[model samples]
Target chain A: MDIPTYADVEAAHARIALHIHRTPILTSSFINDLTGAELFFKCENFQKAGAFKARGASNAVFGLDEKMAKVGVATHSSGNHALSLSYAAGKRGIPVTVVMPRTAPEPKKAAVRGYGGHIVECEPSTSSREAVFAEVVAETGAEFVHPYNDPRVIAGQGTCSKEMVEDLGELDAVVAPIGGGGMVSGCCLTLSTIAPKTKIYAAEPKNADDAYRSFKAGRIIADDAPQTVADGLKVPLKELTWHFVSKHVEDIFTATEEEIVAAMRLIWERMKIVMEPSSAVPLAAILKNKELFAGKRVGVIVTGGNVDLGKLPWAQS
Target chain B: MDIPTYADVEAAHARIALHIHRTPILTSSFINDLTGAELFFKCENFQKAGAFKARGASNAVFGLDEKMAKVGVATHSSGNHALSLSYAAGKRGIPVTVVMPRTAPEPKKAAVRGYGGHIVECEPSTSSREAVFAEVVAETGAEFVHPYNDPRVIAGQGTCSKEMVEDLGELDAVVAPIGGGGMVSGCCLTLSTIAPKTKIYAAEPKNADDAYRSFKAGRIIADDAPQTVADGLKVPLKELTWHFVSKHVEDIFTATEEEIVAAMRLIWERMKIVMEPSSAVPLAAILKNKELFAGKRVGVIVTGGNVDLGKLPWAQS
Candidate 1:
């Protein structure tokens, strides 16, 4: 197995630079005062497809050879990844097929289609999704791009922190939400080499705290059917993501579903940016353990901004 | 009465440089494609106190002489202005008394109080508000900062467009929502001098189209109590704001209430920015008259982001 490195992050950034938005770093004095921490938010939420997944997806779609690129790419995602992969492949004028569960939100499905991606619906279970995805890959002869477990995807995710470190200079710590741990793994691969002093913290929803438990038990903890308002963080960490999680993460913090909702609303109100519940997990973690981050210069990754406006978490009846 | 000039905007920017946020100019290719116009959004919603009122309020608060500065400031606004004045005063370590209607939302009242502004509740009617405000001003000797009509406030608001013109270069047209028309007045003041070729457009809700009527009538038109989802644009244009509007504005466009709500949601969903209904009026206007703005580099000022999330216009039953 070839592990991704800091060099791969550099290569990924160069390859996908034109395809993705070098999203801005936003700071709010009011939010800083409330948290008692100087926070720099790397807004990947404003990326090409409204998530950091665009970076990884762009790398995979754009880095392919002429022969492989013609055949295009395929993936299974119920969230930002499907939209992002489609967005990336569409930019390259390639046809990307997404295997989405039938139960996925209509808006998410529409988004993938809107980006010129082909959607093949599967059953709601992981086993069914994979089984359907495998058939799609075999039929289309498409290059399989696993959502967060692949080296190419992890390298692409690393570009976010690369820009963060470059923009903000030194930071006391960097934090991001951990679901499949793609973003965290990317951060680890980049930060461990270049910004070795900066601590890496992975945030998770308490209702779906498999990553936190896994980190504590020093073993992978798989959750068959975890549920949370931070819907993006329901997946368990895979081996590739676990390798980086175990090696580089300083800590894993968990926030309650209520706390996540509050933080999401706070960011929307104060920062005036649309971010999903998953993006707020880090802020929830910071607010939950203020003592740990007090007076520290922290880099917070705003992972994505793709939320169904009609179904805002706070407004959910 | 002295009219505000480009020089006043420059001086105001320098005076409030440390106080106000030089908010970023965001571009959305998605929104651009939808509207068929190249739009540069000057995000004043991300401004201090979550509105462009911060610029004018900060200028008024900071430009005061030592004696007047000690006397503090007073305003009668149940909206962004009250919170902005309070924020400006708080930054200057001076007292501010806001005369708001007793029926004003709890969150708006709490925001004013949070910024250390003393609040004096008045009846909801305009007459009662003015009557109560007069008494407070007489008692405290606090210099009054009118939300839009004052020369100082107009000059402060001009700085927003000044930054926009500087950031994006010469725009074919600049459009902003008009209620009291402080922002549009500011744009008129600054652009009339610096980029005289740039056309200025004022957007108004058809339900509260006082500015649109006034522009056509060749005189000021006051709507005593017009209602619209864009709460910020309820007040009619006053003398000072009307001066610039009559002299420099190319056209005043009106959008339906439904159009405003749709545009607001589109910005939130596509641009990933939390903008108020008033901010969307300009976009709604652009979208309504797509032929007029098509293929042109247009500057749209997103006036504010202060909205009750629970009562989002689209989510209302």
Candidate 2:
């Protein structure tokens, strides 16, 4: 697969203009005072499916040919990606099937159903999910929309940066959490093209630092049974995402679980926004490496807000 | 005091421009779809001190005469108002004394100290609080900064609507939660002057429906030992606020405790904002009276976001 160009990002922005939310850019004096960085947060938590996954899902659904569109779309996600694909497909009057782990949050499951997606519950394991999704594709003949491992998805996610840059002007650096690396890869690709002088960084939770390890080793790395509050960052990296990130990203930093919790609390208390632990990774990275970001104009992508209020990691017993 | 005219709001906007946050207007397709109203959420939760009280506090502090400035300012509040006064006074290098109930949240007391305000804890009863504040002012010679009852504070709070009207042209109606009535009274005054056709409505919790009762009876009504998740809306209606609200407000509506909790959840889940129960009053009203707001352009002032995550009302035990 070819690397997505800046033109592809521009085209994606135009195509998904009406479909996705032009999420707000939030700046905080409290955050700036704490980190000494002029930070601009792209609030993708306010995106259509409560995450940046909507951008990718919308693009993939709209990119399909008439025959492929008739086949509809399928994906395996126990979190935001499932709901995003379901929402995007449903909006386009297309059928969607989502394979999710049975252990997924009840609210997330309800959201997928609310968006009219057919849910296939699989065992709570990566291998089980992939196997069930394969069977689903075979039975339904649906076009598979890879969550973060496809060029179309990456290009689509890049539109977020394109809009942010348009709205907030050039930034000295851009930071986003690296899960399967779709958002960071897209951010890197877009920033490298539009603002080449800007540094691009990927933040990952220490419990699920496969992307960080991979970036350093110049090869794919996987973490099995990762343990972190940022549940969405547990997925292993794919070659397509790894390749794009390696080419465009400048560095990958890891944030400890405690730091992630602190950042989540700060966003809740100071910014007054409900950010999932995955979304807090970027802020965690900034807070952890304050010296690196101090006095710099930085852009951070808040990737999603799909947290269960009841299960918030910070609530003291 | 004269009712705050559009000119007064414009003047307050200028005076407090450097002191408060120009909070962003938040829009969400998910929330719009759920409510069937084209809604614009003015995120005062992102304002300084985690609420719009900052605007009033800052205005009151800075609006004082040089002689009065040297005397400093004092107020009685459970949380947000104390923090706002502390923050505003700290900026002006003026000493501030906060009279807070002994039963106030620990986090709120910490915030007052964190912002460098001197605290004087009193009994939780309203009479006790008033007596304690009066003693503090008499002993320290600090000018009283009544939360939501003073003209300067009302003028400052009016700036919120001024900014909203400038950004989102010609709103059909503006909704605010009424506690002491500072926010709604200010909003009503400004909307009446600039956008006279725009209706101003106050949302009150059913458990503490003093404002609704007062609006109907054409006299001030007080809630004794008010019980609701909306701690900020428990304060009784003041004479000045009651007068302005009676003349300018189109109506006052009440929402149940369950509806407030549901609205708070919807804001967290759909809009990705951590709104306190008081802030959710407008949302609860909108959700409960959909036919009244259907297809109308409505603006809801999300008053504050200061709920303790550990003790959130909706958190599962």
Maximum-TM-score candidate:
1
Expressed as tens digits, the lDDT of each residue in B221-268 for candidate 1 is: 887667789888888788998999999999999999999999999899
lDDT of 1 by residue, A120-226 (tens): 99876667888999999999999999999999999999999999889888689999999999999999999998899999999999999999999999999888657
Poorly placed runs, candidate 1 (over 4 Å):
none
Q: Candidate 2: what lDDT?
A: 0.88
Report each candidate's C-alpha RMSD, comma-separated, in the order given: 1.2, 1.7
TM accuracy, model 2: 0.96
List iRMS for all predictions. 0.6, 1.0
